[model samples]
Target chain A: MNSPLITRFIFLFVFLSLINAQDKNGYFSLENRLKFGNFLFCKGDYIRAIDEYNFVLTKQNNDTLKFKIALAYQKLERYDESENSFKELFTSQQFGSEAKFEYFKTLYLSDKFETMHKRIADDSFIESSISDKLKRLYNLKHLYSSKSIEDSSKFFQPFNQNESIELLKFYVRKQNLDNKSPALAAVLSAIIPGLGKVYTENYGDGITAFLLTGVLTFLAIDNFNADHNFRGWLFTTLAAYFYAGNIYGSAASAVLFNANVRMNFDSDLTLFLNKNNHFSSNSNLFCK
Target chain B: MKKYIYILILFFCSVSFSNDELARQYEYADKLFNDQNYFEAITEFKRLSFFDEKNVYAYESNYKIGIAYKYGGFYDNSVFYLSHAIRTTENIDERIQAEFQIVRCNILRKTTDRALQLLSQMEKDSVYSNHQNEIHYWKGWSYMISDRWDSAAESFANISDDHELKILSEQVSNDKYSVTFARVISYILPGAGQFYTGNYLSGLMSLAWNVLWGYLTINSFIENRAFDGVAIGSLLWLRFYRGNIQNAEKLAVQKNIEIANTALLYLMENYRGEKP
Candidate 1:
């Protein structure tokens, strides 16, 4: 009720009036838009930030903005756009080497391994400034699909001793891997009951197969000795059917085991490489 | 001094007018929501929340966006935005409403424990004393969705005895089969459990298979054919016996599930009750 209260009210009124046109974060100006776009980007709102960046691009051709746009594309999994952006930076003196690495990275991450190898070979033929480490990585990627890589020694030369040793073990494991041939399994089973299952490393099934066929054969012989011709013929037919089924099942099991081995090797190698960041992109100029 | 008073009146009127405009936009967004255009409504509501400087539309917009998301089956997004609205709203009533919607989303997401915890918290709040019935209602709904018919019935029983949901829950609990009983009966007598569940055809077929295999095993042994006896006994008779018991237990459980489903379907289609 006093003059001080009136003075305080006036002060509040003036402050409120001054902020009338401003938003919660203040005026929606150009600089404010850029700040908001970054704020959204940090909040994982890539789609909205892309909209703001698109607007900003209309205003200037800033190198930082271009890099940010490309990074956004990469994060959103628009690999084609990101690759194009990175490729454009390949001729820039400051970002040339870094862009070249990221360009190949895009090809690799997009599962264009064959195309990436071709590009690597073409670049190497031109004496490109690709690093030895990346060359080794590309060589391994090529070896992944190569049927001629029976010896892993030639591939490990570009790597260090520790990596070469690891690669050597991996190569030996892949080469010396036991593969049960289905035809061999089936043939062995036909020769000796349950022998095919044993050949396929299924010892329990092999023993069961031997016991079952042996029991049915004993039943047939016993029935035949008793002059029960019908029962003897029935037992003989059942034993033959079971023997044939076991041979077929053994072949199928062998095929399945080989498939499992190949699948395990592929997934394990992919996971190991991923854990080591062996295929991660590098854009030294932009990322810095 | 008189001029200053008139200027103040004008400023106050303009501020109120802006608020009215914001309310109109909110109505338009709500219309979109009511029309089942949830995706579009979400964008409109987001715009209202983003541009309203007074922040009056923050609670309404965010909460409606959460509801729209729930209707569109974006459960995780619904919960996130609903929780966000609860924090934005200073009004205790609006806060409770948002929390209730979040509990419903949790129910749909099959996270009943979280829904129950949130419901208990809201129920205990003195600010939500008037909202206790609605809270209990959703608690029952959460239990029902989780397939805990007994717990759900108990919750609805806390309300009036003649409540529609109470009757529905009671029916569901009554219709559910005793799984242990089914397994025990099947263990004692193969195919008897399937018979108990009214699967007569399956029960008879299982019984016939067991009897046939048992006769073959015993007959072979009586004929002094040890090899035939052992083979039929171990491989065929024992396998059919095990299969019969398994089939009995499975049929009983399957029947109980069908019973519970019928009650649930009745509640969904015909019962005039408040739902989550």
Candidate 2:
């Protein structure tokens, strides 16, 4: 009787424990989950952080919490999702300007600069109410999207006198940096052997192109003069092909060189403006 | 007597309470994982591991995290945490499981050398002796992924005589053209290599081009038009001949890759074998 009773007691204990185990919320309360989610967010695991935030968001009406979800998305380079999240606070008045700015940032970071470029110039959107400093900064951003900083006037128009002069000087230095012209390169090579490559500063290739063409042309002429007509014509054809190829290659090199220049200038300008904060308050969102 | 009974009941209740919590958390994490919420499951599993002071769920949670990372395509992280899991557990089976997972990670990340190294090391060890066939199976997968069809077939041949992978790999190897042969033959005969490689149209075009240019040069020379003869011979004929050789070499390599990929794709989709 005693043996049977002890076994029954043990079964009852395990049964009660199993029941508690079946309950979903037996271990971690909702509050503890929120804490763990925040911990994950700080740990740079944005995807998991999103899960936690999404979990807590089910019963919450927190805008800041929502903004964090968007920020986390931005950090993860999921710009599309980030942009959508920022858009939710667009009508909140306090956060609208910041939201719009972040929205633009998402666009910029995603290399959709064309749309951001167009939107900045378009007047139908809410571009007026954002601060004057911010307006100028955005206008400058708009200008940088498509064209190189050819004329500093449009970009400097948004800054104070001192910063305007500083920006002007920066761009003036930028515009003076050596840049190649593909058209001019081709024209030069066409007019004179290897001249276009030399114009593009490819001295070694230019010299090689010159020597190869010169030797082949010389060989062709000598063969023709000596009545070795077949060899002469062969060298002539080769010389002509090389000359034309050199012209085409020089033009392509110049195009690549100019693109590199543009890329460098863009990065330099972005860094300079960011280092100086561009005289605007982009640190805090418009949500305030 | 009543006081002793109360103490016994109180002690049992606390022990069961904690046990219940562990079981609940593990099931919740499992549910999340089964639902395909990998990242969420990772967090839950990680939490369980962190709180399991008795080491009850520590090994399990860490392994789950590794699998989660693998499922998420974070192969490097998978390797990192799986290696950690390897050190945490003393279970021979789980350690081997983690080791295989690491091999999969390396292969998927295109580090075939690392995958092969690991597999070869495991082959030399007595620990994985029981799972030798399984080891060779994954080694074959690694070879198949890298398009080393011959080696893949060799790997599968050890598993069984008529293994499907072995047959598939054999077919891929046989179907592939030797790039060197194509190059050498093209060197000897203009466009002949392309013809041998089943590129009939290109071969015919190349042959016609070479023949036409050859005729032009020869006719010019016979007529004492030396200039025209040399011009046509070097400019058009030589260029076409060189281009034909280049195309033959390139086409042979491309065809081989295409054959390998076809077999790899079929096996990946239709095979009934144990897959990584």
Model 1 CA lDDT for position B88: 88
Q: B8 in model 2: Cα distance from truth in Å?
A: 6.2
Task: Give one digit per residue, the lDDT tens place, for model 2 in B1-276.
Answer: 754674478557856787768888899898998898998788888767755667787777877888888889989888988998898889999999999999988888888889999999999999999989988988998998888989999999999979988988888888899998998888887788898899989988988888888887898789776756765677678889899999999889988878877776776788777666
Candidate 1: C-alpha lDDT: 0.75
Q: What's the true lDDT of residue A282 in model 2?
A: 54
In candidate 2, which residue pairs get closer than 3 Å at backbone N, Cα or C atoms, i.e. clash? Answer: A94-A286, A94-A287, A95-A286, A95-A287, A229-B226, A229-B227, A230-B226, A230-B227
Off by over 4 Å in 1: A1-37, A51-103, A124-178, A228-238, A279-288, B1-69, B84-95, B117-132, B172-201, B255-276
The iRMS of model 2 comes to 7.3
Give per-residue CA lDDT, model 1, range A135-193, as digits (tens).
76665675456354654555776678977766665576666567889999999888888
* RMSD of each candidate relative to the true structure: 6.4, 6.7
